[model samples]
Structures are given as structure tokens and as C-alpha cells.
Target: MPLATSLAIFQSCKIIGVPKSTRCAILRDMAKVRKAERRPPLNKTHKLKRQDWAKKYLKTDFSKVLWTDEMRVSLDGPDGWARGWIGKGQGAPVRLRRQQDGGGVLVWAGIIKDELVGPFQVEDGVELNSQSYCQFLEDTFFKQWYRKKSASFQKNMIFMQDNAPTHASKYSTAWLARKGIKEEKLMTWPPCSPDLNPIENLWSIIKCEIYKEGKQYTSLNSVWEAVVANVGFKKLVETLDKRYDFPSRNHFSRVCLPALYDECRQGVLKDLANVKYFATTTDLWSSQTMEPNMSLTVHFIDADFNMETRCLQTSYFPEDHTGQNIAAGLRQAIAAWNLDEGKLICMTTDNARNVTLAAQLNGWMRLQCFGHRLHLAIGKLDMIYGCNY
Candidate 1:
């Protein structure tokens, strides 16, 4: 329970004590504060479905499988990040929120042969149904890309999709069969199990790239542009052919990954050169091994007036987390990216004293993240009332 709630309980029972002393007593009892992990609530049926699906695909080859999904990208952001700076006891920061979340674009995409496939965006207000989904398949994969593939490749290909009504509808199933994609070629995916989909991981990575540094779009077009630009599709087809075995773990980790990172780093640096002013966010984290790390992300509007965000650095910080040390680390990140300190507008971060002091030490204004503040407030309610919200 929160201290206030616990105190209220004790007061009801005619007990009183200092808040600090009460906290100390709780600590002596081996109680400690910890953050809760968020996860989807899965019932027994969902669990059994996942187990069956795992067993069915345990030894299945995924190289020839094409994974597809439809994702909606909002103008504001993926999670509609609400942020502001306000003093204690202030009401929630106000923003002119729009109806239906300012609209968004729904795009359908897939990955096959280790290459990204069609990313066809649906027309505004167009709800996807069986007929529309079949048309989407015909216009995208069947009419163009799939027809170009070799017959042998097509024979061995498998299509994977979630159990959405449009995906599993009788009309869509019949359409796939008519197009030579029979039952055996369709991968049976588990219900409510997106985490098992590799393409879902790709979507997560793409979204992170699109909305780096808390970047938000004012218009749907800008949001789509950001999505298309930062898709970061990997060029894996060349090395993933049947004649060639997959790259050895060491070769990929040590050589290919580093080369890819360097290429991407140069591109980001080139783009940042033209940016006049940008805001940054920083945070410290620790790995399972307790190795400390700090990250810096930059956000700015580009020449096209599209909000853009990119991670500048995530450096291992073995040094003490003093304000001066953190400031020095941030400076190193800024210097690494060839960023002008004068062009930095501010740093957004949680209400950590060291991080706050670090912003001050770097002569940067600090914007407290309202999301974190809201989380803390909600956490108090959870502790006091035993409410999960």
C-alpha cells in the first residue's frame, strides 16, 4: 500500500507515526519498491492455443514463410505520448485533443525471402473486410511480386497471418485457394499471440525508428512519410539463399552488424548536419548483469516540417552516476554526433535528481516527462487501494 493509504488505515485504528519512521519499519520487514511488468492477460484457452501452435510449428522451416500484418500509425504517435512540464498539485497538462485520435493510416506489409514486401496503405475510412483483404492480396502479392517469383519458390512458399476475421474469412480463404495458396501453404497462427510473430518484432523496431526521441507528426501524411523513410528494411536476401548457408553467428555479430551500424551512423550524422535546433532525451539503465548504461536520443523537425527522431548513442557508463559524470557522458554523445550544443533546445527526462542536475550542468533546460509523473501517481493509487490501474 502507499504510505498515505497505509497511514490512513493505521489512523483508523487509532495509530500514528512519522512517515519516515513508518517507511523505515517497512524496509526492516524486507519490503522494497519495484516496478511492475506489463503483459497482456491471457486466459487458459489462449495459453492452450499458444502451446498447440508452438508444437505444430516446432520444426517448421521459416525461410520460405511470408509473415504479414496490418499496423495503424497515428499522427500523434504510437502510444499518443502526452508530455508537459508542470509544478506539483497542478491538473493534467491540457492539449487540444482531436476526435478519433486525429485519424491515422493503416498499412499492410509483409516479409518474404528475407525481403520486405508490399506496404500498401489503406484509403482513409476504408475498413478492411474479407473482400477488401482478398483484393489487397491480389493487387499486391499475387498480381505483381508473387507472379515474378520462380515456380519452385512459389510451390514451397507459405503465407502466415493472424486470426483476424478478415484474414480467416471464408471468402478470403477461398480466394487464396483459387490463387493456388491452398490450406497446407497457409501457416496456422495462434490466437492473440503476436509476440510469436517475427514480423511483429520488425514492426516494433520500425516504430521505434519512426518515433525516436518522442517525435510526433502533426499530419497523417507526415506520419506516413516518417514510417516509409525509417522502415530500415534489411537486405538479407542476398545472403539467405538456398545455396548459401546462413552467416555464422560470429561473422554476423562482429562484422556485418558493425558495418551496418557504421553505415546507419553516417546517414544520421549527414542528416543532423542540416538540423538547426533539436530536443534530446536521456536515461540511465542497467542490464541484467548490473552493467550501467546511458542513452541519448535527438528529436527535431526536418526541412519538410516532419518531426524526426534518432538515437544518438547508448554508451556503457562504468563511472559513478553523478551529475557531472552524466553531463560529461551527454557531452560525449553530442560531440560524437557532431551536434552543436547551442542548437540543443532542451533535455526531457524523468524526475531523477542526478539527471536533472546533469541537464543543469550541461546548461540545458530540462522538461520533466509527464508520462513518468502520471505513472508515479498511478503507482501510489495501486499501493494504497490495491488497484492495478
Candidate 2:
């Protein structure tokens, strides 16, 4: 939440060492104030459910929880984004971007691997009831999709679904029970949170890949074909493998991250501009695909004699990572930072032949990076101790 205005904050509070304009600019630029519109608020029970969903199940594998969601596949257009600047209570003209009963197809699907489960389409003009949903599970799911699984496979699996009226109804529960699915076995889902559901993103990815191949869709069959062919399921899984969560892009993307990055970068540069001398280190590596890359960093002692380090660049190495090419990239990055060579100390990199040659070519005093040397020393020690053991 933001205060009414910067002036109000300044007037009501003590003026510390911070500047008025700086604080006001931060509020206006970084602090986005969204009006809490009328929406269903979560109760304590829902909060606890969300908390439970967050906790790791030690005895259970994640594959047991079959994440699923529903999506509307529309041919009319990709959902468009709208943004604006406005004052309080000021009205603006708007036009309806979506049609109620035309030009969209409702589909349900699940994803746990590169393979997609059935993208079953809900019939037109048919409001899905508990019986129909259960029928879908028995027919499309059991017969067409998952019936091929081994008994052990199905035995280990636990179904997850949103707490829609149909999902929780007697008909649905009875169907699940007949299939030996326990009621308490279902994974808890927090309401009003699409971010928690990764299957939703899988749908978007398929859609985007479909359109990227061809903008015009003659039939919904072509759309499904694109979904089946082009979507990179493994890549999407690999992306989310390490990270827990990202902040809402709509909030942070517009200004917050970029602004913070720029501020820190400028601060580093300002410090470097004053430092009399500094050293740089380089590292080079290749991807699994054999694409070469280089990473460079600068280190220095600031005015207070505090050891400071900052990564200058990490990007593709040109053509090949030969001595000449590496030197070209190294010089370019250093020049971009406007680092002076006159008062420079030395350049540090692993004792790679090409890298050392590149340093010598540039007339730079080359030193072995202490970090790389220590890493090599540790590797040698491990090898020696392992043989004895």
C-alpha cells in the first residue's frame, strides 16, 4: 500500500537523511498502488490449505500429484494486455474485447512430462455437471489416455483438481472412489491462484508455439496439431527445475527489476571511476550444444580498503574461443565499462593456453585466478585421497 501522496508522507513524518524527491520518485515509479476491488477473500482454512500445498511431502514423490487445469482455446485472438495511467475516480472509455458465446473452445488437459494428456474439449452449449466430468475421467482419461498405465503406475498416482462445484460433488467423489482413489489423497489446491498451477503455463506455451508457426488458423484441429508438435515441454520443466517462484511480472517487470539493476550498475561504475587500480578475471566454458561462452568480472579495493567484486559480462564468445577472439571480446567489454588501462593491476584467468596467449597479445600482465587454482588443487587432493581409500 502507498500513502496518498509523497507530500503527505513528508509532512507527517520526520525528514531523515533521505531526500524528498528521491523518496517521492521511488513511490511514484516503483510503488504501484492497485485498488483492492471487490473480490472473494480467502478465509483461514483456505490460508492453511495454501500453507500445506507449500510444504514438501517427504515420503511422497511429486509425480504422485497429477497437476491438471482447464483452459479456453480461442481463435479470435491471443489475450491482449492493457495498461494506462489515470487519476483517482477518473472514468475511461472501454470496448469489449471478448465475446460471450462465440469464437472460443473450452478444453481440459493435464501435464506431468513432455507428454500431454488428452486435451478433451467440453461440448458446445453443454454446461459441465458432476456426472459429465466423471464421464470425461472414465472415458477420455481412463480409456483414451491413462488406462495404458501399469497397475503400479495408477496405484502410486494421486489426482489433483480445483475445488469446482462439479469436482467436489457426490457424483465425482463416487466415481473416484469406484476407481480406488481415496478422497483424502487429492492434493490440496489454493483457490484463485493460477500461478501455483504450472499446467496453465503449459497450455499457454502450446498456444504460443501454435501461433508462432502460423498466425491464421483455418480450424481448431490445426491448433491442436501445433500444440502436439511445437510445444517444448522438457524445456519448460527444466526452466522451473531450480527456482521456487518469480514475482508477478506485471508488477515488477514494468519498472522494478530494470530500475534496480540500473541503480546498482551505476553505483558500481561510480565506485570504479574513483578507484586508482583494479584487476579483472575471466572464465570460459561451453554449453552441451558446444556453444562457447565467456564470463568476466572486475575486483578492486575501494576507498575504505573493502574488497569489492562485480560481474562485468557473461555472453557468447565470438566465432570460436581462440586467443584472438577471446581477446577481442575481453577488450570490448573492458572498453564498454570505460576502465582505464594506465593504473590497472593485472588480468586473471585460468592457465588456459588461449587465454594466457590472449593476455600476452594485449600486453596485459597475466596472473592465474586464485579461485581457479584452489579449485584445481581441491580436485587433485580428492583424486589422491580417493586412490588411497
Candidate 3:
């Protein structure tokens, strides 16, 4: 309270012997003891949220975060204070700057542990409201970062943005919900805490470099040039890798699907070569196009005594499924696979009379498929249960 108000209150109470001067001194001492008020300090909730995030993802690969943010660059020059030293008599340099507003342009960007992408300049006079920002991300991140890498690389990745008003707005959250990103995945940020965000520091370094060496930013095009020119991508990648221990692109490729595919292919070929004989099962089924499709699948035991199955063929079987026609089709498929008729142990199909007759004509031991028999058995059981009940 003010000294005059304190005095008036004290005098009105009429219970104190202390005079106005004494009251003034007391108020002065209290003011001296009190701390200065600061604006918009971090609260306990934000602190606890940050602590929880750290605990949950302390060892997380930061490389997966597709870090995105908007930066405003003033055409006039960089904002904020700058200091320097001078000789006793020489006048110091005066760079009077204002906060970014009208003359500046808003730019969007996406970054990761392995890459520092974009100075993706936003259009002039455009505001990235909730819907607009989501569209921007869909355009940039999906088309650029995601398409550049394999799906395996994106398994651990997520889109990260600060909790700006638009980013946490209803439209943006709804869009993210539609994409199956829930809770912390989208709103995983605390208020006014830029130090926790590495992109903020990245932007700081970029801004400093753009205005260094007495450079002048005259237009949006020049500002874009300065931003892109100053970013030493080679060094940036190296620094991020060194700091976060991220893998190089080549090393990353080695651990992805292509390598797994090659290994699986080799293993399968080696197993097939060792098997002396195999039985095959064939079936004619209607495809999504409502046309008849025939599939031939093989079954055999490996050298390890483990049973394995592999598909040999799936083709458009001829419409004529008569005994002679089906026999010819089965013979052609068996011959195409280089299986000796003498070594062919057996063949199985549904209990269709024409298929059985075809097998007998082809001179292969014919058997009914156990799966088709079991399906028929289940239908009989349903009738038996209905009659008994």
C-alpha cells in the first residue's frame, strides 16, 4: 500500500502512538524487504509437466521428432540489443530496432536430429491460424521429410510443435486427433519455456548469423538468402549426430527393411534347396474382382525337422474346370515349378469331384484338404445341434 493510505488508515484506527513519519519508515522498510514483481513466471504445474516428460522420455531418440516452428524475420533488420567496446572518444554504434511486426515475414520449417530442413518461407500477409498451420504441416512434413525416408525410419518419429495458440487450437487438435495422435503427442509442450526446445536455440544461432558482419536485410528475398546461406548443413548434421548419436543415412538403411528382406530371402532359398520333396495344396477361389483365381501352396519339413509352407503360384485358372481341363492346368503348374512327378508326394484340394478326377488323371496321389473337410464338419455339427435341441 502507499504511504499516504497507510497513514490515513493508521490515523483512522486511532489506536497507534506512532506518528506519520514512523508509519512511513515502517512502510519503507516493508517495501525494501519485499521482492520486485515479475511478469508471467513459470508455475508448479508447468514444472511438474516438464519433469514428467523428462522421466518418460529421457533416453528417447530426439532424431524422431520432426521439429517444426515459425520464425518471423524483419526486413528492416534483426531485433533486440547488441553491445560493443570503443576507444575513449569514438561514438559507439547505435542500431535502434523494434520488435518484429508489419515488415517481417513468417516462415515455417521442419527439423530432426539428422537434418535441418527449410527456411520454407510463408506467403506474405498470411496468418497461420489453426487450419492453415495444419495444412502447412501436411504439405511440408508429409511431402518432404516423410517421403524422403523409409517407413521404418518414421516408426519412431512424430510431428513436434510448440503449444502456440494455433497449434493447440480446436481445429489443429481435431486434425491431429483424426491422425491418431493423442494427448502428449500433440500438446507435449509447456508454456513460455523456450529453453527446453532446441529449435529455439537453433533459431537464435540462425538469426545471429544472418545479421552478422554488418549485413543489412533489405527485403524478404534477401532475408531468405541470408537464412539459407548461413546454415552450414554439413556442420549442422555433424553437430546433431555428435550430440544425439544419431545414425548416418547409410547406416540407417542397413538396419531397415531392405536388409531384413535380403536376409529372409536367403534363408528361404536355402531351406527350399534342402527339401527333397514337398506336397502342395491348390484351391480355386473368387477374387475381389469376382473372377476365379487358383492358388498353389507347398508344404514340407526343413532339415531342422520344422514344418514350413510357401506359396508356389496364384494365377487366373481357366474357366473350364472339367476333369480333363483341370488335369492339364495342374500338370502345367507342377511342371513350371520343376517338381518331378515321381517325387511329388501328394496333392490336396477341396472335395470337388472334378478336382479329384483331375488329380487321378495327372497320376498324383490325390487327397482332400483337411481345412475344407473341417469346414464341412462344422456345418454338419450345426445341423445336428439344431435337431437334438
Alpha carbon lDDT of residue 157, candidate 1? 91
* Candidate 1 lDDT over residue span 106-137, tens digit each: 98888875577766778777789999888877
RMSD of every candidate to native, in Å, equals: 19.7, 27.5, 23.3
- TM-score (C-alpha, index-matched) for candidate 2: 0.44
lDDT of 3 at 368: 83
Query: Can you tell me which runs of candidate 1 are displaced by over 4 Å?
Result: 1-37, 80-96, 231-389
TM-score of each: 0.51, 0.44, 0.47
lDDT of each: 0.80, 0.71, 0.71
Q: Rank by TM-score, highest first.
A: 1, 3, 2
Which 10-residue window in model 2 sums to the lowest lDDT? Answer: 240-249
Check candidate 2 and list the clashing pairs: none
**Tens digit of lDDT per residue, candidate 3, span 42-141?**
7898788878778876777776777778888776555332444578999867554544622776777767766776657777777888887878767876
Better of 1 and 2 by TM-score: 1
Instruction: Tell me the deviation in Å of residue 75 in model 2.
Output: 1.7
Q: What's the CA RMSD of model 3 in angstroms? A: 23.3
- Count clashing pairs, candidate 2: 0
